[model samples]
Target: MLKPRMIEEKMLILLRQGKISKWFSGIGQEAISVGVTKAMQEDEYILPMHRNLGVFTSRNIPLYRLFSQWQGKASGFTKGRDRSFHFGTQEYKIVGMISHLGPQLGVADGIALAHKLKNEKKLSAVFTGEGGTSEGDFHEALNIAAVWDLPVLFCIENNGYGLSTPTIEQYRCKDLADRGPGYGIESHIIDGNNIIEVFEKISELAQSIRNEPRPILIEFKTFRMRGHEEASGTKYVPEELMEEWGDKDPIINFENYLLQEGILNEEKIKGFRKSIKKEIDENLHKAFSENIIESDTSQEIADVYETYDHQEIISKSNKENIRFVDAISQALKQSLERHYDLVFMGQDIADYGGVFKITEGFMGEFGKDRVRNTPICESAVVGTAMGLSIKGMKAMVEMQFSDFVSSGFNPIVNYLAKVKYRWDQKADVVIRMPCGGGVGAGPFHSQTNEAWFTKVPGLKVIYPAFPYDAKGLLNTAFNDPNPVLFFEHKALYRSVRQDVPVDYYTLPFGKSSRIKEGEQISIITYGAGVHWALDTLEEMNFAGADLLDLRSLQPLDLEGICASVNKTGKAIILTEDSLAGSFASEIAALISEHCFESLDAPVLRVGSLETPIPFAQTLEREYLPKERFKNKLQELIEY
Candidate 1:
């Protein structure tokens, strides 16, 4: 606790000196971090809030790393890409908190799930503020934690304010812990200022969770003695409240308690304080002397962003007729049968199979523990899956409809995609989203949202058109070290059937499949668009057009695209996404940039109108009509 205080003081000095950008002070709330963390075992994981510097200090994280992190030095956990406590080290049992406070709660649930699956007597502890309790992720995480019976300790530092908002405005209940009963979990309110009491209560909670394996929510009633951060002034807090909490400061009270117990005299206390200050000061100087990361857009774009390597391996030797959805189910069955660490989670996936009935009979075969029916919470599920990955478990998360991804977009985009690059941690999580349109599921249930994920740097977006490709790609995704967003078109789930290999096989991520070879013009498409182009090509009379299916969206087969474009000398890009800022536009732009001189005609892009998919069948067909694509293809071929 004293070390955290000294580090806070040093950080404030650096903040004023313009050496560091900001600092989140745990001034009056040191007891909560110190006490709760002290109860946790070394193997247990911790997800600390921005203000919980004491938690890191208690966990034995070196002061120099903290100082270097805040100073944006290359030696920092995030390599200076992130600041403050927005960093993590896999070596330490700590997962650093980002500005988004609530999601970590869901992630902690995943870490607990991993420990439970591994039959390890360890737990995952996470911290959040009272204000963060209002976030949807908090509710989702708590609900799932209870449903899954995960060993997790949730600490809510009710510090009276979230930035400028106070507790009164945040919740109607007298205590945030009061809401835990609704989620079927044990909740308790503890004195935030009393270090010994906090430690004892947390120790009991940790033991109970480890023994019984259930989540416990504890509200540590404390106050923020300083502003939210260095940039945010404390003028919004009432003077009386500030002084009142100031008088009950944990560090000051703990010192008095130690002195009264003959733990230390005034001289010894002074010496200890001086020694801690010297350590912090020396580390601060050392961190300042460390190398700073210089921004290199080209290197970042060319080197660090790409995570895939091509491999040509076949899983199956013989072929058997199977539906696209069944192929996916087969791949999942293989994955679960092969790896005990793998868990399948989604809504109505167990017993009820799934809305699409893709996971039918999985529960009976794999058992309930392996095939889980999760609550209707996308964000929390994804976050928890990431947590499972962190604990050396592979998590397979299913988003019922790709359209619902918007609900959990933050964790998928911010946390899942950036985990590998930020901390060099393997986010071995696969999000299976049933995407695309044509089943009359309307805008809410049917959407081609692949473009949204393709724009993200670290995510691998897989959209397979054929059953063979679906099984192969999904199998590959299960073993891949990085995060993968596997998009299975709902329209093609049961509609498409083919003779797929029974044996295990894997396909390269960034490779393209040429369905037909031709001259004159080239058609680049994927998913439903692949069939749309092939079917339209059969009916239309064009000079001669080759159809290329880009299986992977992110690490695009630029080589295949350019080769086909160079031969044909003309191109037509097709997609089911909205024409305005679609992934198809990216393909078109690539051709215009790379194959500019080779082009004999302008590249033609065919996409749906910038309107939501309608429930009416005729309107839907008109929206993404095959005729429009044929018209564009014929025009490009003729030119």
Candidate 2:
């Protein structure tokens, strides 16, 4: 192995020579990245940190493209939206690069989970700085990865500090790798500067993880060679630090040993550097020639995602129809049949057909290749699904329970939802959040978070009330070239049954479904709430009370709300989501402005109380729709 001292010096030459600009040099810590990357299979992925340029050589990412990215060029993946060091590629299986603390772990979990579910014989190698292990997402990803037995190699390059903060100030542990066992993950510690040791241990660790679904936390004890980046000054080091760390330079030490063993001669070492320098110069020239991604590489190659022929799945009956969940299942079936690249996944979605059995018989019909089951790892499932979507595979992923979505929020909100704006990359991903609260699953299982994601732009959130709407909305979701968070209410999964149209159809999104039109109160709700309000209104002949089922949440049909309220002189917003900052609150505020003159009273908002849900049925029933509240609705109608 060439000493990291040589590699680090050569990298500095590349940077100063402008072969690559703004390099993150692992001056004192080259062994870990280089050793582990070299030990791993050439085809396997290893998403390293900025300092892991040595690993890039092992992974075969052209130095020119890497430099192009750092310089903020379209020729590289930064695509202008990403910082040079914070991006990854699909073709290369680098998965993703996020400069944010611990974001790469989630992507690693995603890639690993996808391989496990799809039965792909591959692994996802994810690296992080030791300091990042303290981040919340790191812990979350590790826990889920361990539980699901994901083939994830989490390399924590313990380079002493996170920018200015020392590791001791952040972590109380002697070795961060020890934290892995609590999550049932296998872990180890290595002298980061020792190439042979790092290479051997990492090779064994990766093979172990790939053979069995488990996470390996390898802590590499090393030091940064320079400041975090070129702009940051490295003058802060103590005087003794230079001599002490310099004596242990892995690159220099390794080169001496290799020469002593005749594995490398001085002439061979010089020739290697000469060849590498030439390669770096050539890569830079190639990167400089290609146009940056600002003008739409995705658009130019847009025809690839155009596998579907756009067959409209229109509903014949808007008056009477099927349960929303059934419609969703039928539409999913149609999408699978129509789109050859489409795939479906969820916990128990295959053998058990999901907890609600919405996907019953799907595994048998589509086979394991298209329909599959996954371990209970939402982030991994969602992350993997987004990756496949990015690769032009249409994915319909489901959360066994909507409440579990928070487990996967980072990828859904930060990555899948914004990948397009970030890289101008289209994520044809549909995440089905099974929500609504009627079930007695308690706080852990009964929460509604569609409103949470509805606030985020770039995500299409839909909450269909009827079966027909579910089918149509799902079809529409599949067609949309953006990320869609499709809400499948567990409460409404089998609550209603109606004969849906045999013909495939999808309802137009961003539109409200007027279940009933009246001159009285404009009752606005969606999902299960749409049924609750309609059932209540029909029992007593509030014949003039119009019921509006808002199918979509993100691109909310506020215009419909204003128009209905303006005529009725009253607006009532309902949701199973908590009252404060809930969907109802937004509707109330929207009505307050858009239909202010039309209000009979401050827009009445009905929803669960601002407390964690109770498992007991009686307490839950009394918790939200208190007797006084139900009576108040009746009193308002009588008035």
State the lDDT of candidate 1 residue by residue for 1-639, as single tens digits: 888887788778778988777778888888999998899997789999888988889988778887878777777787767778887777778998878888899989999988888788889999999889999999999999999898989899999998999888888987788888989999999999999999998898898888889999999989998888868989999999999988899989989989999998999989989999888878877887887779787755543342555455775478999999889988888888877889999999999999988889999998898889999999999999989888888889889898998999999889988877776677888999998888888889989999888988888899999999998888889878788999999889898999999977777788899988898789899999988887887777543778899999977899999999999899999999987889989999999999999999998899998899898989899888577998887677667
Question: Model 2: what TM-score?
Answer: 0.75
Give the alpha carbon lDDT tens digit for every residue of 1-639 in model 2. 333335456557767777555666677777777788777777676777877766765666766676677657766775666664566665565655666656667667656766776676667788888778887768867876776677888888887777767777879977898898888887888998888899898888777767776778778788875777765756776658767778888878888999999999999989987776677667667766867456666653442222334456565644446666667777888888988778787788888888776789988988876787776767666766765664456787888777888877877788776666665667788888887676788888887887788777678788887787787788888888788888877777778766678677777777898999899878888887877776777666578878899998877887888889999987777777778888788888888877777678767877777789888988778665534335656766766
Question: What is the Cα-based TM-score of model 1?
Answer: 0.97
Give the per-residue Cα lDDT of candidate 2 at 308. 35
Name the weakest run of 10 consecutive residues (lDDT summed) in model 1: 301-310
TM-score of each: 0.97, 0.75
The lDDT for every candidate, in the order shown, is: 0.87, 0.74
